[model samples]
Target: MNNARTSWLSRSPYWVLSMILHVAILGWLIWYGPVRNIMLERGKPKREALIRGKELEKVIEQMQRSVAEELEDRVTLLKNGQDRMATNFDTLNAHFQPFEENQKATALMRFEKYAAALKADQESLMQVLVQAKATKNFDIASKAGQEKVPVMISALDEVRRGVLLLSSDETIAQMHALAETALFKVEKPLRDIGSLLGRHRRLEREIQESKAQVKLLGSAMQASRDEHERVKKAYDELAAKRKAVLDQMQALRKVKPRNNDAINEANEVFKKLNEQYKTDRKPLSDANRKARDNKYQFDRVNKRLDECVKAFNGLNIQTKLPEYLQLAIDNLAEASALETQVIEQVLAATKDQADESASEVPAS
Candidate 1:
């Protein structure tokens, strides 16, 4: 029976072919996982586009910091200038009382002596200031560079002035001479303040007008900054998109070299991506250029604002002016009081002399 079956199977070609096909299918199923894993090991994965970003310009940030520090410096310097002015005025203020005389010399001699002292003090103070100025490194914020010498050379100037004016019965004549020559010392500056106020009013009007331009520039600068940020974000996105396209091109080059249709398709896609990248760059460049131009205009406006502020601060009338005016008033009041005393003494002396002369006349 076995021999009969074997003969039958050998005679059936279609049955043998069908068995071989079934065996081939089973072998393929068993080896599928290993073949796929081996191929994956041999072939590298396609490139992945990494995410990207950008930051604002460091130069701009640094310039902002520098401007802030410079403003602080200006404030400190202005304060120092005011302080120095107060110090000099205070020194002169203290020395105005003139009762320091030994009372030995004649009135003219004392006057000449006081004048010499005044000359000496003026020369000494000028020399001190000049020497400080000639120094190698002069910092205007410092006392030395500001010519605020600690020496008391000018401390006796007002004292000398008082001595020369109030030394004797010729006090009225001396006062008239001083008024004609020195114009009461503070009167000239007081007179000049009105003219200065006229200038200030005009400058104030200009400053008000300029402020509008400054505000406009400020708005423009802010808009430019916002646009720059938007453009930078979009530019980063575009860079990411271009990188993705580049990765696809690399993968296509590796996998589709033998396929003309796939290669042509990939080339066409790459060309489109490049063209789109260039087209997108136009807006980015425009945004950047606008931001740059706005920054320059902003700087100019800020500089003008600084100039206005400086001009406003330069008003001498604003620097402890009331105190100076009060000082001048006090000096005038003291002189008037001294004049009353002089007139009273002169009248008393004349009356006593008249009574003695009448007695001597004896019945005339």
Candidate 2:
């Protein structure tokens, strides 16, 4: 036994060494001395970083050069501007002189001559305006000085051959009297017509409202009929379920009393399994419905976006939107359209399933 222990102990060290050597080799292969591809990958990010750093340095140098050149240009411009301003100051002088008494008198004489010319121009312009009113075309250069109204007094008023000329105020007052006489003649009949038209409009609106009410009542009647049919169907289903329950009870009563408990338990288990199936599938159904609805909304929004893009394309491309946004939008819109078609196919395919679900009645 002592020799056996000694031999075993001697072999244990070799086994431990073998395990340690194997572990060390595995560690080296996995982590420390990995494959050549891994080693290459390890250095890839570092190489990229170094390349990016060099590119950034070049960009920085270019920016510095541009900034320095702009600064130099601006400084040269400032120097030139300062020199130009200095030259202007040295070369230029004010030429203005104050008015003398004789010059003022000469200006007054010139003003008088201008005033006479201006009066003649004003009269000519007034005649031109009257001519324009007659011809229905006003040319500013027209030199006609004809009066607008027949002008015996050489102005706005006319003098008839047999009577004293009526002033404009008297003519306006006479026109007012004529207008009053005409209004008195027609006012009552116009009022009666306006009242009749208003009543007609009111009756038309009432007729429209009545038609709307009648339509609403028709819809309500239809809804009530539908509700009645649904209720009647529900009652019939309840009666059928009750009859089935009674039949099941009769069959159970005919069985041995000991087996009745087992049968009832089996029925309870089946019912529970059905309920469980329903419960389990409820979330899946809800999730599917939500996904379908989300797809529908996505399609709608994307369709609207497509329309907007179509309109946007009509705008001036040189001034409106885009660098790459239109391309991205078009791709997304196309994808959305394909997805919508897929959803439509899915819905069409599952329509029978939906109908079956609606038709199925739960066991009572």
Candidate 3:
């Protein structure tokens, strides 16, 4: 009997039994008065419980929506920041654009030409180093040249900047020294040029001021002439009026008895006018003399400016300047020679590497 029970129990589906037990528990809870009494003691009405459940669902939904909106705002801010970064990168790229082509051409023509051969040698050296590592050949692994080759080549490849295999810090320092020397050589000449330019500018400004002064004086002279003509016209009109009054008086005396008081008053007025005219004439003469003096001064200043300009134009700095620049040129030539020496060394090393590789190939 025990054996039969074990076989049946072993064949039974535990999932169906668990479902039946769960249903029985649920039925007991629904009909159980004690469970309902407990809920009532807790002060929760059945109808209010349903309403609270709906309210809780709404609050959860509101929370979810707020979280979603916050996330979306954060994403929008990130996207805008990313766009600004890209714009900044473009602006920075534009700022450096002028030098890019020349740099690329120089690298490609000079450094890149040797890069491929150097890379091949570096790879071969790395393989040798790996083999040596297994054999515990620390001597070969410790070789500075062999160890540096692979890492240096890999670094150059990662950066995509062409290699100058033989160039060393000393060579770069030498070039810098040469450049400094050239700058030192030309410094004095450059300062002299700057000083001359300043003087030339000051002279130009003075000439311009002189021209303005001449123009002002010419205008003043014209104004003085106009005033003199106006004074002369006024005096002529007064004299003519005096002559007409006298003639009228003479004619009236013949027709009737003369008015002596009118004649005497007219005579006195004419005398006064004549004296005033004479007084004004001296100023006219003074103005004419002053205008002539201004013209003479203008001419003298203009002549002086012309001579200064001629002297400045005739002066030659070219012969002296070339001597200064020639020193710089010589320094540049020396730097170039040093670079050429490095390039020759790299070429020779590359040739030796090629020959070694060729010899290492097996006869097939």
lDDT of 1 by residue, 137-233 (tens): 1122123212322222242343334444443446544543443333243233333433555667777877887798889988998999899899889
* Clashing pairs counted in every model: 0, 0, 0
Candidates arranged by TM-score, highest first = 1, 3, 2
Report lDDT per candidate: 0.57, 0.46, 0.58
Candidate 1 regions off by >4 Å? 1-176, 182-187, 195-211, 303-319, 324-364
Error of 1 at 122 (Å): 32
Candidate achieving the largest TM-score: 1
**Local distance difference test, candidate 2:** 0.46
lDDT of 3 by residue, 216-314 (tens): 877776776677677667767777776776676566566546777776776777677667667867766776677677667767777877876776665
Better of 1 and 2 by TM-score: 1
Question: Candidate 2: where is the Cα deviation over 4 Å?
Answer: 1-185, 188-192, 205-209, 212-220, 239-258, 261-364
RMSD per model, one decimal: 50.2, 44.6, 31.2
